[model samples]
Target: MRQPQQERSRTTRRRLVDAAVECLAERGWNGTTVAVIAERAGVSRGAAQHHFPTREDLVAAAVEYLGEEQISELRARAAALPDGPSRAEPVAEMLLDLYTGPMFRAALHLWVAASTDENLRAVLVPLEARVGREAHRVAVELLGADEARPGVRETVQATLDLARGLGLANLLTDDTRRRRQITRQWARILEPAVATRTVRESA
Candidate 1:
């Protein structure tokens, strides 16, 4: 039926994106090509091109797709909260996931490539900005306490930045618990910073 055909098309497109993500993560950004994605997806280059006309098009979509996939996981983590202060635990946990998760690993790989490739930066910069802003928004929406502070955004973003750094450190050293502990400590400390800033702002 027409619906089945449409579903097949959608699945193929999703497969291409999944293939691209695996290729990028496993092979690194520069190592991945449209041909490689096609091969990984079990599709012809022409079929891949039909879905994504240019190399950059596929790269950008892969980045956005990976981000969306990760955010979905984060949303589920957020939703699992118990509807009270206890919810902050999962929020901190989600932040941990964004930093150390597979999707972030792929994203960081793309970022490393984008740093030197101006053309790639053109494709990736917007995505990075969106991800950063969205991460901050998620922290505020899900984790921020009452009497929200003016500098809460900074605290949350800083926590993310530190987690990212520590994540790479953990990647090289295979030290997951160390980085997780750092994030947990920062999450506890950030609340007071927010309260202090809120008091100052309210005065």
Candidate 2:
């Protein structure tokens, strides 16, 4: 039936995208290719090309697809956060977890490639911008950050930037022990920095 054929087609496309992301994370952009991804996905080269005519197209789709998956995971985790005065530490840890993962690794590879390839940049710039905006919005919700408060927006953005730096550090070596310590300290600092005070004060 048409329904079964459509479902199978969707499955194959998902496999290709997932394989592309995994390949990007493992083997930098120079190493990832349509043939390799097709092999990893257990699909034929022609099938992969049928879905994504070019390597750039495949990688672009992979980044957008996984970015959404990560965002959805972030939102789901935010809903389950424990209610208490000390939620910042957990939130900080969770946010850091976002950057130090396979998706981030894959995206980093794409970033490096895009830096030199105008064609890749043309495809990636807008995708990353949209992902960045969604990430910022979700971070505000998770941190209970009041953007109206002075420095609060910067504080929230700083947390994400720190997480990214930590993720970059992790790409070279194991930075877990130190990363945990840093995020813990940042959480303590962030709790007050992003606090929404009722009484207005002069800046």
The model with the greatest lDDT is: 2
The C-alpha RMSD in Å for every predicted model, in order, reads 3.9, 3.5
C-alpha local distance difference test of each model: 0.71, 0.87
Model 2 stretches with alpha carbons more than 4 Å out:
195-203
lDDT of 1 at 16: 89
Which candidate tops TM-score?
2
Candidate 2, backbone clash total: 0
Ten residues in a row with the worst lDDT in model 1?
Answer: 194-203
In lDDT terms, how accurate is model 1? 0.71
Compared with the true structure, what per-residue lDDT tens digits does model 2 show for residues 15-128?
999999999999999999999999999999999999999999999999898888888988898788654436778888899877888889999999999999999999999988
- At residue 33, candidate 2 shows an lDDT of 99
Model 1, range 74-175, lDDT digits (tens) per residue?
777677665544454556656765666555666778888878988888978887788777766666666644435466667777767876776677565577
* Clashing residue pairs in candidate 2 (N, C-alpha, C atoms within 3 angstroms): none
